[model samples]
Target: MASLSLPQVDFRAAAAEGAADARLREAVRNNTLRKQEGREARWTELPDAQALRELAARIKQHTLENLDYYLRQLVDAVRRNGGVVHFAADAEQARQIVLEIAQQTGCRRIIKSKSMATEEIELTPHLERAGLDVVETDLGEFIIQVSHDRPSHLVAPIIHKDRRSIARVFSEYFHAPYNDDPPALTQQARLFLRDKFRRSEMGITGGNFLVAQTGQVCVVENEGNARQSLTTPRVLVSLVGIEKLVPRMSDLAVMVKLLARSSTGQIMTVYTNIFGSPRQNGERDGPQEFHLILLDNGRSQILGDPEYREVLRCIRCGACLNVCPVFRSIGGHAYNSVYPGPIGALLSPLMFGLERYKDLPQATSLCGACGEACPVKIDIPRLLISLRRDMVNRRLSGKLERLIYRLWAWGLQSRFLYRVIGALQRWDLRRRADADGWIARLPKLAAGWTAQRDMPAAARRSFHNIWKDRH
Candidate 1:
């Protein structure tokens, strides 16, 4: 019943705002730390966790390399299984395709499962403008819709919201007494959404994995809302990115084993829906019409570049988010895309232009936590560095920033200049130190470094000087 449109994202501004919010930071820190711990515990249950991650990565890479062949095979298979396939070159086309389907079906009441693809295209607002009543069925998504707020995390959408804020939102939305209890909030949403599920004429979802061998769209979720989206409507549509394809059912099996564990540390989600075709003659109930929209907004560009194609291996498990220090502190809203965290830092720039999301590449600390936590073993930090390099090469970085780096390079080229600059920097920094020998503030370009953290005063003697004295 409600929708959200993301405004122009200023990563620096948003990151500062999120960092300044103690409550938001605490909420994100607690949730992500818990999930990170859970993921570590779950991975230990495996005989060879790293090996499995490598195998999964290989499967994805192989599929991406031969994506055309698998996609063709998938299209043929889906057609044979009584499913229609649509290709969208971009976001506008994707929205238009779904609108056409709704128009053709003469459908009005629509219920959507939690879908990042849908969020990426801002589908709900488009559908609403077409005079359709669309409801978000997933609990977190439902809350997001009700509050007109964007999701801050892939798996845990409301990680930025604490119980008290959620209680106020629920109270205001339902016009009922405040209740912060998790079960009560869930029950409240369930009761409201059940009616929408029963009466919906069309259902929309996003595919977690599209199995090329069997033409089945695999969707795993902790809640049964996705299950309801599949069964309750006369028409069902799954809008998925083209990169979601896995070569075979066996590959899908391997992915399933890691997805839930990486996301929430569960061995398996409560619902795992694998459906492609419309209901058969003998079937009691299922969608009468099925449509799969393959979206390629910017994936083809990333896939074509061998240097960064590994970024596509991301499965949206939110494992990287849980382990990323920047995301844990500043939260997902700072990334300014439907995708967030370490993966988003790489993706938002690649999918969107480098200039549009230039700041995203600089968001990471390059701590390698995301890379280690990634279930598919995607080299996240490497790819982020790649994106950062691209930003510089493409002249997306500020002129002053580029000039500063050039000067730094020039200084480093000569030993004398390097020593001179190092000594001057140390002397200046030490001069700025307070009585406690901590530099609490800095001027100009170095101001941001001291904004949130104090720099330790430099030693009186340089390492070179100390070495000369010893000699």
Candidate 2:
């Protein structure tokens, strides 16, 4: 088994660094805003977008409620179709299972599609350590692989990167003249990967949804890389989270309707591959051996808790990330988790613990954009608030922070203290104002406010004072 231990995450530092990068901020903001606009445009084409989202949420909720039963059914169905199913208790177990399969099948070369689940388990390095040649076939993933960079977005892996950066990477890798053309870069990669695909003996993928009724793994993609990953190799392995189950194929219809629209604003992805089992007697293509590894990895603990279980309904479409004010300011890597943005804020704390990822919940502005943007309606802001309350209950908050909040609460409950605090706050703010009336700096606790934007000085007269004078 490979080591899964991770060092302490400094989310605040990473977020601050990302926020300070003007070029990175511009790239991420422009891409996400365009996707958001496309989503809104696509939503208008639907008869009842909200109703469809509700239906999709209900389907996921139903599957989660009866997960055990669905799991049994899914396993049996896969077996009936000549496919194998394996249960992994965590990331270590999941990696071990794939390694064992690789060893048994005598596979040396592997091709992998873009799967966040595989990334979540950190499978690639373990395989590389085992001396197997593994290549990321997805164009974005390929860039990330060669450049030694992590994905910054769910759908668009290299959202933080510009054409210049990519061209530099490609030029260095291919040892060719600098070319920033999109088609040329894509051709350079495609020509390089075409040979790898031909030689790869095994394929790896992540599922968007698992249809329990027919034991099919449905993977959606704009590019055809996932299709090749499924059909080009003799042995196929799919690593999917346990929470990805959908009870019926009809339910998959409801999910598919919202998935692409919510993700990149397409009516449907260019390729939506739904497959089960290995190739049958007359099949010329497709894998001869298939294995599905269902990963738990702290999900069972999350499922057992009612307050946070609804988050399991997420389809990972990343609509929330696109519309997130905080994510727009600071890209995905700042979250310091395989998942990022509003969803990552909830998941990291819930799956890992509040102690390691306490700053994640505070990353959001609680603007409710994530909740409204979610296709599955996960209510991310509500979950974030719940996590914050949990943090306070667990004494994860600092002593001074708790004291300040307590004092603030106490002052709010008393009229005299409220007025006194308000007067003092106004005076202090006014005193800090520069000649132009913009406060460029703030005192201790509120200093971060002026770090990016200047604050305006409070008005000399209050509304209450004006009303009293008029009366």
Candidate 3:
């Protein structure tokens, strides 16, 4: 490992570039989002948007409902198309499979693209530990990789670091005498990576969607690196999340239309490749062998939970992060998960289990901006509420916290219980009341809430209490 200037999480952050790209997009999003909001404001005006959303929702719902059947069908189709499929239950198993493949093919160098599934598993460090030279090819991913920084955004991993910081990274890493300039820094990486791509023995990528009907694997990338990686390498491997399968190629048309547009406001990326097997009979350039690793690191457990199945439809467009005020302020690092922002808050717990990040679901203001920004129209806020319910049901919340909710529920059960507590609090609250309707200081347990903002002096009188007396 290189002793770099960036945060420890930065390395992990860039591996999932879209989550990182969020940093760069946040400001620009403010101006552009207004137009998107205007366009979406007239959502009723564009009935087609709702119609497309319904179609997408139904398509994903159907796939999730019959997950087993679709996964098996996808595997069979890929195998029949002359591609190999490997199933990994967790990160260790996935890494081992990749390691074994790398060792088998005797690969020394590899080029990779932006893949959050790979990051959630923390596969890159494992590969590096296995002593393989892994290179990130996406511009943002590459910058973060070289600088040893985490991604602050979902779509642009190196968004937090502007050209000046990136130029310093290149200068330090490559000894390329240069100043802060985007084109100069990009060209430096370009020239440096060209040789690495040409010499790499294997290339690893993530799939956008797997079509079971035609056995086609779709990859959407902005740079030409994905094509170069697949074509230049002797062996090509795609590490696809199990949930990425689409029942048929026709379904891909709809998703493709919405994917890049929603993510970057572009109609489509610079490259969109869909090829099942390697180069057919006499094709010029493509991998000699193709392998697909279907990973299930807790996706199956989530599928059975009725409240959250629709979350699987996320295309990783990052529109939610762009619109989220919280994401804009503290950024992705605070969440401390590979998937950050609105989607991360919901998906991380379900995939990794809720106990570790129980506080994350509550990290929202219940703004619903995420749901509004979503391209596939994932009801993120609804899913977030479901997660909160799960947390309560599991009793994972702290004892004091649980006690408060229980007390509130009990109080709501009857008017008498509420009045008694209200009277006691009103009398006690007056001693500490400030003209501005705030109690600046509070008890120990309540400090967390008041530490950040002023808490209204326990409302002088309960609304219902006053209303009942006047009425």
| TM-score attained by model 1 | 0.96
Residue 457 accuracy (lDDT) in model 3: 68
Instruction: Please identify which of the two predictions, 2 or 3, would achieve the higher lDDT against the true structure.
Output: 2
Model 2 Cα lDDT, one tens digit per residue, 1-471: 122355676888898899999999999999999999989999989999889988888899989999999999999999999999999998999999999999999999999999988988888888898899999999999999989898888888999999999999999999999999999999999999999999989999999999999999999997798998899999999999999999998999999999999999999999999997899999999999999999998899889988889999988889999999899998999988778889989887787777888999987789999999999989899999999999899999999999999999999999889888888888888888987788988877888898778999987767766788986
Write the residue-wise lDDT of candidate 1 on 1-471 in tens digits: 011246676788899999999999999999999999999999999999999999999999999999999999999999999999999988889999999999999989999999889999999978988899999988888888888898999999989988788889999999989999999988989898989999999999999999998888999987898999999899999999999999889899999999999999998899899999999999999999999999998999889999989888889999999999999889989888888898888888788777777888787779999999999988888888888888789888889989999999999999899899989988998899998889999997889789879999988888888999876
Q: Which stretches of candidate 3 lie over 4 Å from their true place?
A: 1-47, 435-438, 456-471
Give the winner by TM-score: 2 or 3.
2
Residue 309 of candidate 1: its Cα lDDT?
90
Query: Alpha-carbon error at 338 in model 3, in Å?
Result: 1.1
- Residue-wise lDDT of candidate 3 within 1-471, one digit each (tens)? 101112333323433453356554454455336535543554434447767777877787788888889888888888888998899887778888999999988887999877877776767777988899999888888887777676666776754566777878889999878677777888888998998898988888888888978777788988989888778898888898888888987898878877776676666788998866766788888888888898888777777777787888887878787788767655566667777889988887887767766767887899998898787778999889888988889988888889988888998788788788787877776667687767787778677677777767666678886797987
**Clashes found in each candidate (C-alpha, N, C closer than 3 A):** 0, 0, 17
lDDT: worst 10-residue window of model 1: 1-10
TM of each candidate vs. truth: 0.96, 0.96, 0.88
Model 3: lowest-lDDT 10 consecutive positions: 1-10
